[model samples]
Target: MTGLTDLFELHHDGALAENYPRLPGLLAELTAEELVRAGHLLSRVDADEVLAAQPDQRAVTTVITGPGTLDGLVAPMTAETARHGLLLRPVLAGFDSYVFVLSGDDPEIARHQPDLVLCVLDPSMITRELAVPWEAEDAERVLAEKLDLLEQLVAGFTARSDATLVLNTFPLPHELSAALVDRRSRARLSIAWHEAEVRLLRLAGEHPSVVVIDLDSLVAEGIPLTEPRMSVYAGAYLSEELLVRYAREAGHVARQITGLTKKCLVLDLDQTLWDGILAEDGPDGIAVGGGGRGDAFQAFQRVVKQIGSRGVLLAAVSKNEAEDVRAAFRAHPGMPLSEDDFVRITANWDPKHQNLTELAEALNIGVDSFVFADDSPYECGLVRRGLPGTAVVGLTEEPAWHPRDLLRDNWFTVTELTGEDRTRGVKYKQEVARKTFLSTFSSIEDYLRELDVTVHLGVATAAQAGRVAQMSLRTNQFNLTTHRLQHQDVTRLLADEDSIVFTIASRDRFGDNGIVGAVFYRRDGELAWIDNFLLSCRVFSRGIEQACLAAVLDHAFATGVHEMRAIYRPSLKNAVVREFYPRYGFTTHDHDDERTVFRHDLALPVEIPKHVRFTGEIERPVR
Candidate 1:
């Protein structure tokens, strides 16, 4: 089989459309030589050439600058962005198109206000004391000063704009100490580097906009010192290999910040999870623990478990007998996974792709949200070719590489976690029960009333800010504008006196559905505009949407606003809600190929659904 790197050489000129989305996966397979070659080739391609070749590009503006010589970085980074953009184009309505202004020449980073401000720095630029820390008289004091400078740089940018700032952390050199004991201890080299990394990370946590790339974490042994010839001749302080690696990693970070994160991880149970095929080698006979290849499988399972804990839904799609697989989840003493960890488990006689489609519906997430990992190339190929939206990982036959292969890609990347993230898996599992309960009811209206749905519509509270932001990020199916916002944006809206944000939380007899829907609108002069309107697909097929819309209309009427405007920007995933406004008596005020502008006259009466209950005793029922 031809390697992924070989495939890129044939299609790097943007000649193929079907191959664009697969470039990021192929880029990961490049050898050091291939990576450098690809980087150089990309650097030569101009933005106009890139645009002419691929008109499907999403215009993403960015300014990349740092404290050192980033001139050589411009071309390679641009190439990486173009390729990464092509990969993300299909999934992200459009991939980011980046244009750069040199580091010192143009410092309009905060002025222009681009989508991303990527700051890259070298470890060699650290405190002079760090270079010879073993003999420095005041190493600790010098280190503290350097850290303060780093903090100021990050804090200053965050204060200027809410745009994402991805700053690379300092990498520690292994040669800092000859003794392993001293290197691991509170000695000068270890303390200086480790404390600097910790402080930068803490600053990142304080602001939602700051994202530290963690070069320190990506390379544990630290990056190799620049060769004397390359440093002098080419003005390069880092190896070409490391530079190519960092470029790819940074590209992944950009995707996450822009809300291009995957939601679900589907796995095959046989050789993928454990060492042996389950039915052939019974639960006890399966190679699961000790010093065998089973140990490698254990390591891979731990990584998947860690991701699940963070919020990614885990599912099993295998051809084993249903009861046998359930028995393994229960009986396998060495299994790190439980039945609770998986939201959907399909172990049946049907084709794997058929099971995956049902899983996507049950989860209420797009097929694009899934990343399937299986040991069989045939199975992985089946899903990749049949369902192009789902990202597929063909796990290596060698067990040791499983974890490394999966984690290296960062498929489920997110800029930051919300309060709802930790409970995401639990909520989906509860959804399984919700599906079963709905089956017990006959009529649609009766089922909704039995749900006893309560939507609290008003200004959102501090606790609901994360969920409000999450609704914007995750609700593409029912979202009108597709404006993905972070919690800080929601917080700003809540603090603004003119803008009002509404949150809808539902609890059926089932359980607390949490905050599943939200809206942001403002009254300007005599007209009120809907800035964002989104509802989670989990709450679809109920009267929740109609009730939410009615409440928004009533709220606008109470504000003494005469007219209302709603906008819809077309995207592949949001097609379901295209005709929503016109159905509710909204007139088409303006029309375009990409967006439709709808206006509603507030003089007309609003029909609030009777099924949805309201809390906080603030209901101005218009019906």
Candidate 2:
């Protein structure tokens, strides 16, 4: 196979610039061997052009590879990462590109402090005796040894480093044995190997820091597993095509880790939900869920259902009449999703973008948390242009590929599921009820009074840490400071003697809205500095923010804190709370480009809201 040396022989530095522009057309025509060679050469320009334009603004990610000739794999991974960086430039905020650090097998994982650690262990790395495994007795022994080694490595990495680990499960060889085994004789080696794979896949569930990428399934799904010479020269096992997809998936993991993941999927009806236009064909004429042409729609709906189970809120923003859409969902026999599944539904004939805006408002989530999917290019384009924050997915004409296309973007991936996730669908369903109840009240205070709301301001227990961390990541609009934290980080804050971490949960006549606020404060002598102050938008405009601040201040004062300091670092999405601290009686002492500092004298009495009843220690802020 043509190697990197061959690429060097084919093109000198002078030819690189000329060939770069024609790179796309050239890739399709290249053989597997030549593609590998091209990847090596592409590595030479590691953001050379991208960095020349953006300069010193790349998102830094470190890649710790497993045992093998993996050094050769670095260039291809970097090239793929650079391409994705360009695709995700808008999502990355200030970063225009990504620069990666490729470390050897098992360097000090904690010392590196990488944003992500890609665990690229191959089957050979686990057990070298696969080829020599015609012997029956060594099979279980081999599997056990491999499992122990794998678990030890993962456990150690997680214990030492907080970096999100993306572990690739060991893939069984396409042809596992020399011949088919007679199961009556002994345990089949193939069966043993398959069991080992299952055990490897289950590691993600046991650990909070791991996201196992199933390369085995990727290959089975027909991403061609070709490795010509790179495995020999560079320890790389995947083909160029497979490697490209792997890197894309890796980038998705990285995006989710950084809180860049979208929260909601706003879908369209008509051809999108069924085979025919609902308005033109009428409800009965439109094809859905009775096999034949509607099979594709059913398949797509099933995928949407699966995603919702994993905690992505589903909603419909269609142009059809509300009654027609309701009837269509009710009439379809095999419809995978019901109206109940959707957290919000805007079925009227208003502008799709306006419906999306209303959905965001009703859900109390930012517009950027949305992913709008529609079969029509016109409707998708409207939302994309009108609501710049929402992710607009372009659909192909073929309905069969719709679900696959949606999955390709990797909008929702989290390292761990929180308490909030398990009940997210229920909470969002309840939110619709809460939004309806809001319109009945004359004023915000009256609404709060009528709901019989109660606020608990106490140090969050270990069990509630995950939900607190989630609010820190998802609460952008009402967040005083946009500091993204994970559950482990919140745990660390709790252990610090000088830091106070508080959790807020509110329940009314509607339902138990799980822990929705997190505040982290650091004690400095007689002063308490607020590091993060956030409340879920679900409880917004209800004087809950006032109640929260008053609780925090009262606690500080009781602890002998002379003054309270807070920093409000504004972001593009957090402008809604730009003046949040000032509204709650915090006096601005310093202002700068990065953050605005506010100070409150703890000696001064705080006013508690009349609506919310308190449940924990400390007096309700004095009126």
Each model's TM-score, in the order given?
0.87, 0.80
Measured with C-alpha atoms, the lDDT of residue 157 in candidate 2 is: 62
Q: What local distance difference test score does each model get?
A: 0.70, 0.70
Where is model 2 poorest over a 10-residue stretch in terms of lDDT? 90-99
Residue range 304-412, candidate 1, lDDT tens digits = 8999999899999998888889888889877888888999889997888888999988877788788899989889878866776677888989989998778776888
lDDT of 2 by residue, 1-623 (tens): 32344335535644543334333323422444455556666666534554443432235355545554345445545444433332112111111011112222433433546767766666655345646535544666778786777777777766666677777766655544434366632446666777877877888877766788888878877876657576556555556566666766776776666666788888887777788888888778887777776899889988998989888898998888889889888887767889888887788888988888888878878787888888888887677568765667777788888988788768886666777786787888788798799899888777778988888888877777677777776677788877778777777787889987888877888888878787888999997899988888777777767788888888888777888999998776679888888877789989987789999986666676788777766664343
Q: Given candidate 2, what's the lDDT at residue 154?
A: 73
lDDT of prediction 1: 0.70
How far is 177's C-alpha from truth in model 1 (Å)?
6.4
Worst 10 residues of 1 by lDDT: 89-98
Clash pairs (backbone) in predicted model 2: 69-234, 69-235
